[model samples]
Target: MTAVTKIFHDRLQVILDNHVAEVRLDHAERHNCMDVAMIDALLEAQVWLAERVGVRAVVLLGEGESFCSGLDVAAVVSTPERIAWLLQPDATGMTPAQRLALGWRDVGGPVVAALHGHVFGAGLQMALAADIRIVHPEASLALPEIEWGLVADMGVSVSGAALRQDVIHDMMLTGRHLSGEEAVILGLASRLDEDPREGGRELAQSLALRSPRAVAAARRLRREAPAMSERECLERESGLQRNLIGGPEQREATRARLEGRRPRLA
Candidate 1:
């Protein structure tokens, strides 16, 4: 029996297809903005994915024209206590905002984000947490927190996007937006495609076919090594390589390469 439950809440959808799970932000009328309810749905989804041992890849995409448009200011401000609640950590020891932004990453599998339209603030943070990002040309991303006299807090500091200090400062100070093409050029996006959703699925499928162990290890190294010193990073890399070089997954990968065919390893 499948261990994962099919959840279709008001603001989110969790659907598993084969080994690739798709988590969709579905509140399109509000540009799929992150509110308290959606955040809770995402938290539940993180646990769902974490418990599903058969899932090899995760694809996060929005339901409408936009992937996400950051927080719902009107909704958030309407509730006085909600703002304070966003800062409270759940059972996962992660704040609500952090859990929503980084939940997909917590799953021990590759996460691919397909972005289009407005990818702002928390949306961009989610993309940053993704191991691979595929964005459409028309997508526009921004950190508009400064305009609202707020910081783009949502645990965005650990984002793996290769943005320079100057670029980060400029965007944060001005709340400026970046196009999808520019995002790719600036290393915020892995690649640009006409149909980002399809592209994300293709990338996730490719990852799902690979050895999950190797994929997870590489993702961890890429996602976390930036915070380490050069020497520490190098040592970690070598240690991971040594641990993987002769492992079952590596051996299967090698055999598949030698046979000139797709690997059939589990």
Candidate 2:
């Protein structure tokens, strides 16, 4: 049976079904723009998902016309308390605003984002945090913070590390928009889909059927490989494989493959 949970007054809705959790950003009237309240909700939602080891996959979506139109600057800057909350740093020197993107990394499962319409500034950064991004061909993505005399500070440096320096420079300097197809070509998005939400959900559902332990290990390896030496990566890969060789999930996977049956992993 599926379970649904709403938190932060439904600004964030989490639907957990068959080990796949769909997190919906529900502030539709403003294209799900990140207001102070919405930011709080997202931060909380990420923290909530981080604690759930059973969640094999996560699909991030936004309600209504757009995935997200980026930050509501007027709303965020007008509130003193919210400003303080956004700026306050944790032990690692990461602010709550920064956490909005990087916190998704704490979730123990692969995250897939379904993006459409305007995915601008912080919205683009948030989508970039996802392991896979499914975007509508017509979706507009931009790094518009430069237009406001601000840098893209919501963990853009960390999340966009793999992007070409020239491509990053062009978007940041020009504050121009890129369509979903162009984004895919530039390596900003995983793929373009006619219905990104459905595509994201289908992908997440398929990932949920895999052995969670193996999936988690692979996810970690993918995240770490870029930073590790080739020798270190090989050693790490071998160590992880050794740990899984005789594990319950591994045995189950082997048994199911041989029997031509779906795996019932723990």
Candidate 3:
């Protein structure tokens, strides 16, 4: 194993090792709830990760009992200036709050979110942005924004499209809590595990063994296929394949298979 590099942000801790980065929310005393600082840290972390092409996989988890308890409503509402900053739109017309969740999608490669305990509102939206979600069977998952007199605005409009319309509507309208098992059955979660953090780490480590280029291509194809026409989809698929077919990583993968050895992909 390689030595890990740990970077601490305002309310987050990022550990980088051998192409896998663990992004842990560190405000455990408050169930790792998203206050202004936490949200800022999240967005900042994404910016950091975006520049590191060596980071092939990311495992997103919380430090303590819960992954996140969603936004700290009273805290945000108390500071008028913070609210304005949170809602400030960037060049893409996406508010900081929206990017805090959606930015994970653009962070170079795959993101595997480990969900346990309280995963609500903004927290769930953040998880939904990940390519894979490993959820604890007993973890509580909910939209919970309706109860706070707000809609699910943390990029749920984009990520929630992967889920069933009825299920999305029910969760959005009622703010009802669902178990992680139910979440998987309802298509909100990828899978259920007793220990989501460990599961996520295992999955991420496995992903790290593959070529980052291939992994990124797969993620891009999956994400963009929905909106593309069939002809465009096929063209995109072939284009991506052509880019990868004669690459060094692909050749190394072929050699490793022929040699019956594990691929040491970079």
lDDT of each: 0.83, 0.89, 0.90
Which sequence of candidate numbers ranks them by lDDT, best first? Answer: 3, 2, 1
Q: Name the lDDT of candidate 1.
A: 0.83
Stretches of candidate 3 exceeding 4 Å from the true structure: 1-4, 7-10
Which consecutive 10 residues in model 2 have the weakest lDDT in total?
1-10
TM-score of each: 0.92, 0.95, 0.95
Q: Which ten residues in a row have the lowest lDDT in candidate 1?
A: 1-10
**lDDT at 145, model 2:** 93
**C-alpha positional error of residue 231 in candidate 3 after TM-score superposition, expressed in Å:** 1.9
- Model 2's alpha-carbon lDDT is 0.89
Error of 1 at 229 (Å): 2.6
Per-residue lDDT of candidate 1, residues 215-266 (tens digit)? 8778878876878999999998998889898899899899999999988876
User: How well is each residue in 1-266 modelled by candidate 3, as lDDT tens digits?
Assistant: 46365555559988888788899999999999998889878988999888876888899999899999999999989999988888889999999989988899877669999999999989999999899999999999999999878899888888878679899899999999999999999899999999999999999988988887899899989889878999999999999999999899999988988998879775
